[model samples]
Target: MASTMSRLMLGRTLERICKAVLLLCLVHFLIMMILYFDVYSQRFDIFSRFNNGRGANASRGPHHYYYNYSRPNTTFPSYLPGADQLLPTAKPEANRTRPTPKPIPPCPEVPPGLVGRLLIEFSSQMTMERVQRENPNVTEGGKYTPTDCRPKQKVAIIIPFRHRDHHLKYWLHYLHPILRRQKIDYGIYIINQLGEDTFNRAKLLNVGYTEALKDAEYDCFIFSDVDLIPMDDRNLYHCYDQPRHFAIAMDKFGFRLPYAGYFGGVSGLSKKQFLKINGFPNEYWGWGGEDDDIYNRITLNGMKVSRPDVRIGRYRMIKHERDKHNEPNPQRFNKIQNTKNTMRKDGISSLTYRLASVKKYPLYTNISVEIGKPPPRPIKG
Candidate 1:
């Protein structure tokens, strides 16, 4: 009888062990599945409906269409600046010859001519799903061009980005329609700073110019801030007779040009025009100096900012707190002070960066570039 009981106990023990092993294997499989989905597409399981996501928030109201995480808002140090491993590439069909564009006003007029700046309303919150649903015609990669007419000029609109995912959704929601209306053959680019270092606005713009050209021939380049939305479509996106400053007036500055040299918001240049200035200076480490430096580069290149009358170039800046690392550069005025002296030697001709990844998302060509910290300027006497 005692032998029988001992055998029975041993059998129970083996069964328990088998069950535990089975449980562990199931857990491992579940974990791997979660990670794979997160990395590949970021789409969530049914449980995602409960997560509201991060950064900005919004209720599913009348504007509801779809919902998904745009991107992680976790702050990261600047990516270690490295040389680009891969040059930009065109999509498989990018080289296909397009139909020649019809005349500029290929579509119907909306109120006829530039009726001055129209006031626009921006929602307090935005969503990746909403943008996708509304712009169904935008295709998988945030690219759109009028099919009916061959555009007059091809443009690359570049936005330097960091931790502002919601702002980007809004930009797409508005700009896609506006660009289509303007009849521009354009591709949207969001050049994202990859590291947790201080945001280098100018360097990102330089990378945009390089990567955009590498992918295709875009003769006109528009360097735009993500937060600003245009109030007027009349601020034609096509290249002008000279470099055009698109955001001449902003509601932030009372819809007026802030100052004579204020070129911070939105500006444009043809390929030859951008090359003439040798591109923007790569050394403006923080926010304040780059715009002024660009203006100086323009001036040094024997060019001037050809702005539309304030009424035609109206913009509304989406409000947000300044980023922690983007504190106003006390040295900005000094940087501007030396634009002419340093521009010839320090602009795009001297630019260097490593391309970490170039992802073509449904909405834009996201070029992840790693730029190094700029060398400190020698203390001026």
Candidate 2:
């Protein structure tokens, strides 16, 4: 009986110890599961906030949120649990377009540097080299634009030139400063007739218009006599709605216009205005008739000569003897009478010439061409 009692007590003690151990393990497992769930909740909350922030930034534009999180330098620890799955993958930027730049505004009408009524002087010692040194801003081919502002117009000053280097020196000396003051984006073109054949001033002017366009899209063409120089800086070298007559009162004609219809000296015409008149008549081979013929063409196209007041339009003509081959054309009167009939067919459309050479100098671009001699007189029966 004593032995049976001892065995039963021993079995009861062993069962109690086993029950305690089981209870402890259950409590530990419950705590571990709670801690794990808490950690997962915090991680999920952080990931949600990150996703929400990215979503908020999406409305702002791609540039705001674009970043290279997966670059080659980025490293992840393989030891960490689920390190590869920590964040959502980023998408590639789609359909990106660069912003367009704004256009530059046109320059002001009257430039700040303008000082009206410039002092005019001429000297015998002035040379091309000296003129070039004075106008260092003028680039090769005589191009210049104001550095401070965009120019109001692109002007091409076309001088029908031949044997007049001395006159040209005076012109370059005075005109370069004046043009800069006026804030003109301009180029100087000397259209030279190659052979000693009668100088076709009008044809050479047309050649200037065509050749200048080859270099730049010049909207305004100022056909000028090489000898004439403006006395005022305010006589701006730009285009207007009407054809501009810059040298309205030249000193050669006693500072007065010789006639009501005189369109000689310096004139400015827009590209459109020139094309509308079919350009100056090519048939006027000599000095006397071309200007008048051009005036008639202007009127026939219903355009008038625009000019500033005499005070601002003043000019001084450099005196020189007439060129040998540029004598008065005896047929000038007859050609002037028939301007309307010949204008359309005999202007720029019917023009032809062979270029001898094109040279760019420091102060000007010289274009020499062989405009064929005057059409031989019709053989009389």
lDDT of each: 0.77, 0.86
- Candidate 2 global CA lDDT score: 0.86
Local accuracy of candidate 2 as per-residue lDDT tens digits, 1-381: 999999999999999999999999999999999999998987776555445545645333222212455688866544434433334444445744668977666778777788888778776589888888899999999999987678867999999999998889899999999998888999999999998898889999999999999999899999999999898898989999899888988887888878888898899999999999999888877668899999999999998998989899999888788889888998899999999899989998988999989999999999999999987777779
RMSD of each: 29.9, 10.2
Q: 1-381, model 1: which lDDT tens digit per residue?
A: 999999999999999999999999999999999999876553343224224421134233222213332458733223412112111222236666889955645543332434445567775567777777777777545677776656667889999999988788888888887776676678899998887887889889999999999888899899999999999887777778778888888888898888898888899999999888889988777768788888888887777779887777889888999986777777778888898888888878998899999888877888888897756667889
Model 2, which residues run further than 4 Å from truth?
1-105, 378-381
Cα error of candidate 1 at position 256, Å: 1.1
For all candidates, the clash counts are: 18, 0
* Residue pairs whose backbone atoms clash in candidate 2: none
Candidate whose lDDT is highest: 2
Q: Give the TM-score of candidate 1.
A: 0.68
Off by over 4 Å in 1: 1-119, 376-381
